[model samples]
Target: MMMKELHYSGSFTVNKPPSDVVNFITDLPRAIICIPNIINYEVLSKDKARVRFRVDLGNEVPIAELRRVTTDAHIELVSASGNEIRYKVDGRAAGSTISISLVIKVEGVNNGSRINWDATANLGRLLQMIGRFVNIDSLVKSISEDTIKGFIGCLSK
Candidate 1:
């Protein structure tokens, strides 16, 4: 079975300093709170967390019982710099690995920051096979929205 990989990059500006945005994005525990449909989330350490979230894959084009994936995720911040942060999420959902990685870069703008987010997901064999029959754009959009929510949540604080 072939694995399906998803990748996307986008940028937005927040009314906060670059350093503040960077700090918030690097905080895995607080960031997790901003994600939608979070069933469970625990801050295991400064760099790692245990998370569980619900993903509804729409009214199952080919099956009914398998449309929803309850994901168990292990999230970590692998690296960080003054303006860039790299994180990893190792997750299992519906008997498949839904691992993802993200890199965020924040740069100072007029009075706020221009934040760029890039993410990739390595869907395991099972999901890859199922992906061919499903529209994966919604999943991708969900991930992007989740990340942006975290950014907004951070700036709001």
Candidate 2:
């Protein structure tokens, strides 16, 4: 089996405190709604979430169901620095397993807080096969970027 991993990093300046941006992104239900392909998401339990969605890749539409396991949908600071929030998400969809580790860092700047996001994903073999043909990485990247933008827009309003 071929193991494929993807890493994405981006930053945005929000006209709010770090706490506000952190709170916004940590809301699982609300955050998932920002995702383009997500139909809906439900909190199955304290540490679990289920999502129903369809990924549109040009002519292909892959309907998917994902379950995420996490301590909470809120950011947790790991150290006294208070600059980073760490989290992990594990799920399954599209006949494949998905695991993501994310770290969001916030820094107070002159204008606002500079929100830095880094995410890494491990794609199972089956999903990698599809990715090879359909440029899944770029597609996913676009979706994620758009989602972040949407969230920022909502925060601004």
Candidate 3:
């Protein structure tokens, strides 16, 4: 299948220090739970995991086959230092291959930390076909952004 790349970035503040944020994120078992729609996850090691999640296509996609799908991804921490962390995820979704690279940076602020994150998603032909009918770009971005927001929100609590 063919691949198309999509990029997204966002920043948010949490009521915690940079160290706390880094620690929480680096703890694979704890941090993975914050991912949205995550059905199950297994920590393979300190920096790797197997994750299964479901995507909700909402009412936009007219095709029932593409409306809701479950995908499994292998997540690995590529690097982490100070307040920055990077990860790579590879999976298959809707009969297509998906790969994602994510980077997160944290900065200490007054009484909390500001987390900035960006991700690149390489999607396969199935999504390209789906895009022809709906705004797949927006849907992907919304889901990506929500995942990050949810992660930070959960960590803050």
Candidate 4:
């Protein structure tokens, strides 16, 4: 099996202070509930959780079963201090391994706050098989962007 990597980085602003943003992010139970497509989740501790979610692979994977897969991940909040939060994730879906590192930085801006985030995902096995025929990276990227946007939108409210 081979591995492929995908990277994502973006920023958004909301009408909230940096401390408020940091508090919300560090409060995993409150913050994680905002994530979209979550089938179920369990808070393992103060900074760790197990989440199950469904992924819509769309029409890119050829087979229907492969088009929509359920994935489970273990997420750990590695660090949260000041205006920054970091997480490490490991998961499996469709018989493949997935590893991710994510970071979020908050900055005060004009009475509000700006959230800057970056993530790198390493996908194994499943992506290699699907990549031979479809642009899996783009498909995954699109899904990831949508999920992130939805999460941020939830926080904004």
Candidate No. with top lDDT: 3
For model 1, state the Cα shift of residue 31 in Å. Answer: 1.6
Tens digits of per-residue lDDT for model 3, 33-58: 99999999999999999999999887
Residue pairs with backbone overlap in model 3: none
Query: How much does candidate 2 score in TM-score?
Result: 0.75
Which regions of candidate 4 deviate over 4 angstroms? none
Q: Per-residue lDDT of 19-125 in model 4, one digit per residue for the tens?
A: 98888888888877877789999999989999998888778568878888888999899998778899898999899888989999999999999989899999888
> What shift in Å separates residue 107 of candidate 3 from its native position after superposition?
0.6
Ranking by TM-score: 3, 4, 1, 2
Which one wins by lDDT: 1 or 2?
1
Candidate 2's residue-wise lDDT over 23-139, tens digit each?
766655555556555565776643346666565556443423222211112222232235676667676655677777778788888767898888898877766766655677787
Off by more than 4 A, model 2: 45-48, 60-81
Ranking 1 against 4 by TM-score, winner: 4
Q: After superposition, how far is residue 100 of candidate 4 from its true place, in Å?
A: 0.8
Model 4 residue 73 CA deviation (Å) reads 0.5
- In candidate 4, clashing pairs total 0
* Model 1 C-alpha lDDT per residue in residues 6-87, reported as the tens digit of each score: 8888888988888888888887776778887889888999999999888787775477766887889999999997898999
- List where candidate 3 sits over 4 angstroms from the true fold: none
